[model samples]
Target: MSLLNLAWHSLWARRGTALLSLLTIALSVALLLGVENLRTQAKSSFASTISGTDLIVGARSGPTQLLLYSVFRIGNATNNISWDSYQQITQQPTVKWAIPISLGDSHRGYRVMGTTNSFFEHYQYANKQPLRFAQGRALENTYDVVLGAEVARKLQYHLGDKIVVAHGLAAVSFVNHEHYPFVVSGILQPTGTPVDRSVITSLAGIEAIHLPPQQQAYSEQQLTPSSITAMMLGTQSKLQIFSLQRQINEYKGEALLAILPGVALQELWGILSIAESALLAVSICVVITGLMSMLSTLMVSLKERRREMAILRSVGAKPRHIFGLLLLEALLLSVLGALLGLLSMYLILAAAKPLLLSQFGFYLVLTWPSLQQLYLLLAVVIVGFIAGVLPAWRAYRYSLSDGMSIRI
Candidate 1:
């Protein structure tokens, strides 16, 4: 028989076991590739969210904390800068334009960010791309609101719908400001950032909703306004960022801090670096375990195939034929497993990309594996070759020893 026929027959004789082995290898490959892809895209997403902004100014806190609250909307701010200070900073000669962010409320688990129309004009993400409107425009009045793409899709609200501003971020609010409902004026296009999951409005709208109800008789009583959350500042000159940051940090008027958004984001990733490392280590282990399992299974099956090998020798088949059969089985099974794993990975990433981007500000690029990934695949093939060697070697040795005998 030809080498191809011998290899085919050998695999078919043990189809049950071979198929199981292939499945296990395929699953392990999928796990390794999936984790690596997630890690890479997550880092890209985190880093892309706040590009182009010079500084993030907020109440006193660590740089990472400020980034989490202001940029990622991951936590709450302890204090807010007064409107007077905000105005003073914006008037600086080095300042080009400023966009203040007032946050503290949420609509159905998404954050509410109150800013000016300038925000849509100036704020950028993922390669400095401006926020595009899917429907309508930015809010012109304090009573108007603009929903992010995710918020619009999730809530099913269209333009001109009335939405209530709650007292706090909770779903159940006892202090509902029913008197100051906002009209949905616009819905922003998807930007693959936390902004896509937020409710946007004018700064005054945030203030108005939080303002205490006034009794008809209390004209003279001083009103204590709710503190604003955070602000993102843009400058005319890139060189002025450090100076402005220093000024904001040293201001004697209020307890506040300012940071370069890019720097703070890097610091935040440093803090989360351990999680990334752990994921990488786990993937490597999975790949190693997968290769070992394939090797062990092939080696075990060789012991039972010795009689079959001797019979082939009696039928005038060369020892090289038996060796090629074992090696071919290893190559065929491994390549199939790898292809299946890659396909499964593509399907999963396609499904999860939108959710990942909106929720975590990560835009995953799904494409062929990178050079490093290709090298890893090549290593897997090399591992298969090594695994097949012992079985092929045993078959060759048996052929020389049997010498046409019908011995067991």
Candidate 2:
């Protein structure tokens, strides 16, 4: 028989132990690849969350914090920049287009962001992709609201449905601006970003909700937002973005922060470095444990195979052939485990897609294994080969006379 066939027969003789070892290694490989998947996908998701905009300007705060509140809508802003500052900055010689953003209210659990129609025209994500309406048109009236894909689907809301705006992020709030409920004029398609969970309204709608009941009747043209949560700016010249950012940061009109979304994303990722490292370390440890278990199984099996080794040697099998056979068995198990692990990893990701998107706005897409992940699997195979050395050597040392007498 060929070495591959012999290895398969040898493993089949100890099917239970071999099966367990294969599963353990497979799970380890899956976990290792899963971590890598999360790392790369997270970067992609966050990086693609906002694009085409050159600068995200907000009230004075940490760049990462501003990114969290303005783009990700994770937390409340420290303060809001004045609308006057917004107008002033947008008029700079290098400004291309700007969208004003106001936040801090919600419908049900989704964030309520206030901005002009400019938002629809200027905002982009995932390679300058513009927002498309699944149904209805963009915000056109003062009391008009736009429901994101998740909000519309989860709430079962449609165009013309009036939604009460709550004062805070709670599902049920003590204060509700029911008097000036917003009519859902549009629903945005899913972009796999924070926008998918937002409840959007015109800037005037946000301000109107704050006004007294008597003053609620208004035209958007007559209303001016006194303050806004943040602003997204597209520069006229990509080369002068840094200079404009410096100018915005030093603006005499107000204390503000200007951040390049890409750099701030890197900073946000830096904040997650510790957690990422911890997760990676834990995955590595699990893989090590799995490999160790395989090694233990191989070593224990060598004792039971002493007679088989003796018989093979007697049948004219050289030490080299014995070594090669044992080594091939380890290689076979490793290769099978790696392949099984890859399949399991993709399955898990597929199952986790909706949950991750719903819970954290993380959209998982299955792609081929990254080069790094392939190298990791390759390394696992190498380790498995090395792990088989002791048992292979011990089996190679077996003499023909060893199987002549049996030990109870």
Candidate 3:
């Protein structure tokens, strides 16, 4: 029989041990590839959270902090900008439109955002895709509020449901605005962004809720918003972005800050780069451990297969043939492990997609293996071949010395 066939039968004879090694490599590969996939998808999801807006204008603070609060609702604003400043910036000739944001409220842990109808009209995500309503329409009355897809699902809220907002951004706030409860006017479609976890309402609704029971009777026109947390501005021309940003930053009315959302998002990602690198390093170590396991299995198997190699050598098999046999076996194992790893990754991603989207707003998309994954698989095969070389060489030397020794 050929060396290739002989190696195949030899592997089958020790299927139990060989299968264990294969599974080890497979699990390691799956973890490595899974990390890469999550990192890529997370970056993409983050970058697509907000689009079309030229700048995020907020209280003078760290760009990343402003981004966290304004765009992601991750943190509180250091300070709020005056309503007068928001009006002045929006009325600029270069400005096409602006959406004011008022934060510092929550309902069952989901952030409550106070903005205008322009928010639903101008806000964009995932390559400038406009927000679509899953049910009902944008806030039409002073007490109307909108619920994000996740918010509605988690809280079991529907249109016309009266929900009270809390004063603080906590899941169980002691201060609740039960006196001025809001009726759910709309529910937005899922966007796989921070918006999915937010509760949206009109600016007037925000003011009315915060007002005391006596002042709650004030008209929407009379109660001008005193201050807002942030504003997303869309410039008339892309060329005027820097000019507008600079003007907003150096405004005389308030100490405001303007940041390019994309730049701040990149900076935020850079801050997390160390964590990403650590994950990759850990995965690499696991992969190396798996390769070592494969090497150990092959080295241990060599002792029992010495007489088998000598028999092959007696049948005119060259030392190179014995070397190729062992090397090919290792390569086959690695290749099979890599294949199984990819299959398992897909299965895990498929099963977890719904849970991930619901809980973390992460939409994991399944696609064919990426080029990076291909390179990783190639690297595993190379490592496997190298791992086999020592045992293959040891067998070759034994075969040469044993000559025609057939005693098993």
Query: What is the per-residue lDDT of model 2 for residues 123-232, given as tens digits with 9 covering 90 to 100?
Result: 99999999999999998888999988888988899989999999999888989998988999999999999999999999888888888887735665547888999999
Per residue, candidate 3 scores C-alpha lDDT tens digits across 1-408 of 776788788789889999999999999999999988998889899899999989999999899999999999988898999888888889999999999999989998989999999999999998999999999999899889999999999889999999999988879999999999999999999999999899998888888877778763687565578999999999999999999999988998878999999999899999999999999999989999998999999999887888888878877988889889999889888888888988888888899899998889887899888898899889988998899899889888877777788445
The lowest-lDDT stretch of 10 consecutive residues in candidate 2 is: 399-408
Q: What are the lDDT scores of the predictions, listed in order? A: 0.79, 0.89, 0.90
Each prediction's number of clashing residue pairs: 0, 0, 0
For candidate 2, the clash count comes to: 0
Q: Which residue window of length 10 is worst by lDDT in model 1?
A: 216-225
Number of the candidate with higher TM-score, 1 or 3: 3
Task: Report each candidate's C-alpha RMSD, comma-separated, in the order given.
Answer: 3.1, 1.7, 1.3
Off by over 4 Å in 2: 219-222, 400-408
Question: What TM-score would each prediction reach against the true structure?
Answer: 0.89, 0.96, 0.98
> Which candidate ranks first by TM-score, i.e. highest?
3
Which whole-number lDDT from 0 to 100 does residue 4 have in model 2? 82
